[model samples]
Target: MKVGYEFSKESCEDPVMKGELLLLSSVMFLLYVVSGCPERCHCHSFSKSVDCSQQGLVEIPSDLPPQTLTLHLQDNEIHQLPAFAFRSVPQLITLNLSNNSLSTLDPGAFHGLQHLKVLNLTQNSLHSLENRLFHSLPQLRELDLSSNNISHLPTSLDKPWENLTVFAVQQNQLQQLDRTLLESMPSVRLLFLKNNLWKCNCHLLGLKLWMEKFIYKGGVTDGITCASPDTWRGKDLLKIPHELYQPCPSPPDQVPSPAPQPGSARGAAPSLPEDRSALAECELKAKPRPANLRYAIATFIVTAVVCGIVGLMMLVATIYGCAYAAVTAQGHGGPLAPTNQPGKTAGKELLDSPAA
Candidate 1:
């Protein structure tokens, strides 16, 4: 009776264990079916992370894991990016939408990603960007807009791209950049402007002066050439390195006229002479003044010394020639006054002499 009871209890526990194992297996299979990515996107999921980049996606896909923080959609045919394409990624820190066909970025496109950093939009077809397009991403930093077709920048842009550093806008079509655009970005360093059609003009006077005043220099030195007006084409602006936008100078031949007011002193006068004088003073102060007449005098002295040395050499040669002539004259005195012997001529007797 005891053995029968023990066998029955063992049978009941074995069936319960088998049932629990079956239930666990079924739950695992269901989870795999639900969380796994579809066939279109070649995704690899491990534990709680997913990687779905370079899958030839035309648009931002739906049904991505909500906990995914790293989204890499590089090298695709994604042309138009919806405003809320990244809205669901709350924890996303790194977003790479590089090497795509993104032409324009609608304002407020990058929203809901407060912690996002390091946005790379390199190698795209982007031409123009709105001023407030990046208004929402205040915390964004390290933006790379290299190798794009961007031409213009907002003149009145005064926002802090918060904690921003390393702004690269190389290989673009930027014609002009306002010097004031760099005033608000005090924290920014290392601005790249290579390979662009920079139009240097009177407006660029501000940049030229700014770089001189603060002892700061830019990186696009020789590459910043003039593009417009048909005169400055193919000419590098920095090669001249001269200040362009200075106060207008008076005509060289024009004379200063008295002030229109009768009793006005020169202090209050604003004639072209005063303006030109002010400009001259500013130029002298800004750039080092050229060496004065002393340099010319020294150069003249050196030339005179060289000429004097050459003349001395010629005089010495003349003296040597005269001495040689005098010695020859003494040697053939009077041509050995007609040799007494009829057989020997005067020239032949002198030639046959011991000295000869």
Candidate 2:
């Protein structure tokens, strides 16, 4: 009886010891995760967010929590971003890097952020972006690049942003936009493009046509106003008439073949066909001369003057005909015509009747 009582007591005590050990292990794990966060950043385990904004961080922290979903690194003094800067935090969803001094980004700066949705890079000094810079972020939705100094966008994208919804690029130095870039974002809904230096020339005609279709399909824009060519300045791009683009010269039918190099075999194929082909491609992509705008204006003015002259001549002819008809009618209706005819007839009859 005594041995059985001791065994039962030991079994109950064993379960309690196991529970204590498990609790201690969990506490130690939590401490480890907290300690893993960067010294200047605060990590919230429950929300999986990291806050490092306004910390004067000159560079991205190397030690970021693997489970981090949201990262706030705005208002920092970071100047450049290296390749794969966020590879450690692959699950990042929202990244705010606004108000930084970032002027350069490696092509792979956003690598490993497959699930990132929103990125804010406003108020930066970015003058250009590398091709395929955002290729790794396949799920990006909203991208804000307003208030930068970008003069142009990449002519071609390595991967299309099929899921991008909202894109803002206001207050830049962009003179024109490549229509293909907008076409790549098939799912885009809102586009903000105000306060840019838009040149409403032949190069921008394609974009104007695309905007019409986009707006017709329920997309929205703030309207791009021209800032150049004096005549088109202060006018909305969409309002410009299509006739303005008609004066642009048609593209050349083919690139002229380069002259043969001296001392080369006459019948032998060119040694640098690749270089020639590249030259031809560039020529095909070049924008039409800006002088075409002047031609269009001149044509419009001449047409207006001709039409005005024709209308003036018609008015003068109508007035002259009416004045001449009024004078003839007044002379015929006057009493002088009847009196002269009667006097002449009476005089002739008396002269004929007189016998002496």
Q: What's the C-alpha lDDT at position 198 in model 1?
A: 66
Scored by CA lDDT, what does every candidate get?
0.68, 0.85
Which candidate tops lDDT? 2
Estimate the TM-score for candidate 2.
Answer: 0.65
How do the residues 285-307 of candidate 2 rate in per-residue lDDT, one tens digit apiece?
Answer: 23344567788999999999999
Could you tell me the lDDT of residue 83 within candidate 1? 84
The alpha-carbon lDDT assigned to residue 79 of candidate 2 equals 95
Please give the lDDT score at residue 201 for candidate 1. Answer: 52
Give the winner by TM-score.
2
Runs of candidate 2 exceeding 4 Å displacement: 1-35, 158-160, 250-356
Candidate 1 local lDDT, 1-356, one digit each (tens): 89999999999999899999999888976775675554555544443434555678888777665656667778888887768677766666777888989996767677777777778899999998877766766667677888999998776445546366667888899977776765655556556667777666555666556544333543222235666535566666555456433453554445466556866775775556445544333221234545688998999999999999999999999999998877876898743344477756666768878982
